[model samples]
Target: MCGSGQLAVLLVLLLCALRDVAPLPDSGMLFPRESPSREVKELTGLWDFRADLSPSRDLGFQKAWYKSRLAETGPVIDMPVPASYNDITQDPMLRDFIGWVWYEREVVVPARWVADEGTRVVLRVGSAHYYSVVWVNGVKVTEHNGGHLPFEAEIGDLPQVHMMAADGRAAYEDVYTLPVGIRTVKVTSTQFLINNKPFYFHGVNKHEDSDIRGKGFDWPLIVKDFNLLKWLGANSFRTSHYPYAEEILQMCDRHGIVVIDECPGVGIKDIRSFRNASLAHHLVVMDELVRRDKNHPSVVMWSVANEPASEMPPAGLYFKTLITHTKTLDPTRPVTYVTCSNYARDKGAPYVDVLSVNSYFSWYHDPGHLELIPIQLNTQFENWYGKYQKPIIQSEYGADAVPGLHSDPPVMFTEEYQKLVLQGYHSVFDQKRKEYVIGELIWNFADFMTAQGVVRVVGNKKGIFSRQRQPKAGAFILKERYWRLANETGRLPPWTKYSCLL
Candidate 1:
């Protein structure tokens, strides 16, 4: 062993995702050094506070104090946050009032943050007692009950969870019900069979992210995405990188859209994170995820992690235990983990029921070499299937295409380049899909917010759809390709002949 064994830099997603890849444009800075993708802002200081003192105790709501300055509505006392108002104030009425006590703090947001639409501003409340609601410029952003643990809200739009409860009792009996589709999913060495027929994973990887709302769920966005999916004839999707909202899975169940439910196991890069304690926590998350999602028939597989550092020695044991625990929880479904590691070195490859791999031949590996994709992609599939003898999924593949970007001869980050990348991958898939490859999920369903960087224009531009759900040129390409898939393979929707949704 070395005398001190100290390292200067951390290598994340190292060796695994980065084989034969181009070098970084710049060197790494030391720890705590700021980069384009990192940011921090604190909201702590003075606020104006006033308790509802009128007899009815609803003065703030009635007068709409959130509309304007709380000081203008009534007499306000200076207050400091990070301390409870009841404990800080001297007046007994202010201390004992069992009503709305409004606290307003005026903080200026830099114009640069607003001008750069890709920048995401989040408001984190350290602690708010009992209940709280927040507003800015008369637009409600968030509300919460219980405190101590930090809570955050995106500044653009209202959270949909704050919707008023509807009285369903008037329309129906107390026993709530939904239509359930009964189906079966089976996996063998080279195929995924749904209801006794071969099935292909022709779908997208989705995130519940959008412009303005961020991760805030909105009904309009939800319905529109579903419509878009239908129009593309997409039969399935992976709840990529992490689980989506429960309502999304329910919609999948209703509309015959299949799902590969994944947990929040993306970027398990730090080798130290594969310790026993971390593995135990990972198991607990799997338990909760399976318990929540086992009822949905649309869920064909359980993907425990995405693009983990499986080449690390500890990964074999970690993924083995994880996949075994998941199968014990729900033996009806096959379990797998997504890997971006090379087949020869990926330690976790042998244990999963299906071999799911992600690679960008022309994109991440050999940038600007579109001709490299067919040979490289075909070799990738061959090597994986030869070693594992398990059905393989091209879990993720796509190029970043900035919306409205065009190039006459195809160039990276342009719409035409993205189209060429897909065509290259498809050429390989057309050769292997019927033989051994069972699925192909595009890198993203839509563009999503990411930590900003030079390569990312505000966010990852890998989606076929823009962040606003508008169709990019690639969308039309997928639309045509998927429709052809539907025509050739009628069982793409598993429930194509049945009216399973009520």
Candidate 2:
């Protein structure tokens, strides 16, 4: 058993052979098999919508409101699809509404596009907030939980409506099947494999957070973030606490950025919440997550939960059930839950395919003691490998560095301090590469807004780049580190040349 001090010294010594790595290969098509011969319709027009304010129950879903043309209702109004329901109205109640809201639109399929054995009608939604269910001509087609990405249902042979003379009533019949796609992601005992090649995650953890959107889908923000990721030499990112807008994932697929598709299972701390309602809801979220993202090649893995209470015995069972169900949904990808708990003590660690542990060594644990990070991180990695014998990814690790803050010899929140902290962590990462440690994704790609509190000046300032997507001084340090790692790991393409920032 290596002590903490010995481990730190070993990591420092291993850093002597420091070297370079790059962007991942193109993630291929998000929704593949599209061509000029196929008819693709944009469902971006106004749709009849209403909010269920009963508060006691999900009246819209429960009453099967999708069966009815919502225009027949009195409170219905035309709300735009592919936009957040929050900002579409001036009403504060509607903007802040947390419960069920119904959206309905009538889509007319071109007669020429529908033919027996030759045509397929796939209804692809860009994104919907929270939970959404769809219907076409009084028939419920599909239901999904996540708000960030797109979900599609193949509504085969649009509903046939006929009048029944006996009762003077109309009847409808519709048949549909889910789309089938290929799965190419695999995980070995040593590394994460994509299409059977060892793919290192050179990336960051990000949130779908920005100004005014409040988790709403925004295309400009998506483009900007992708550009930033490219510039930073990062080719991957975890969706952090939840799934992002489908458009973003589509962009990732186009750009070759691998994604760890995570669910919105954040803040699940209490044991009571862990058991009855939360566990059931978690499974639903998992089903929806896989249904929406399983087709995308960029989505390499599923992160079911973020920072859950994994040490608890109940949490072990809770995550075990969730992971087991997730595998059933999409076995092509590995499933993991991001844990902030100690790896040696965490009961939930055994249930996941990969061990993703979040550690804040010098920053959160021994604040300002950067020297202790190497040994401490080494011991933790060794202990986890000893027990589980699984590949590990340092999923979240960073110091909160406010832009422009500076100090000689490095102090907390300064750019210098952030650089040093990352250096320390990277040193251990280099040493542990020979061991089971597989990847390192920093806490954030860029700074983002969090709830207002005394601890946060504006929001979480741990990003290598500012919220506006501008790089801090620490960004250069990471760029070099990532570029070097990519080169060393043979991830860099032959066409690219290595250059240093002077």
TM-score of 1: 0.66
lDDT for 63 in candidate 1 is 80
Minimum summed lDDT over a 10-residue window in model 2 is located at 8-17
Q: What TM-score, to 2 decimals, does candidate 2 have?
A: 0.72
Give Cα distance to truth, residue 76, candidate 1, Å.
Answer: 14
| Predictions: Cα RMSD each | 18.8, 14.8
TM-score for each predicted model, relative to the true structure: 0.66, 0.72
Residues 99-194 of candidate 1 have per-residue lDDT tens digits of 566777666444334334454555655434435667766666555433222345566332321212223222222232445678988888989999
Output the number of the TM-score-best candidate.
Answer: 2
Candidate 1, backbone clash total: 0
- Provide the overall lDDT of each model, using Cα atoms, as 2-decimal numbers: 0.73, 0.72
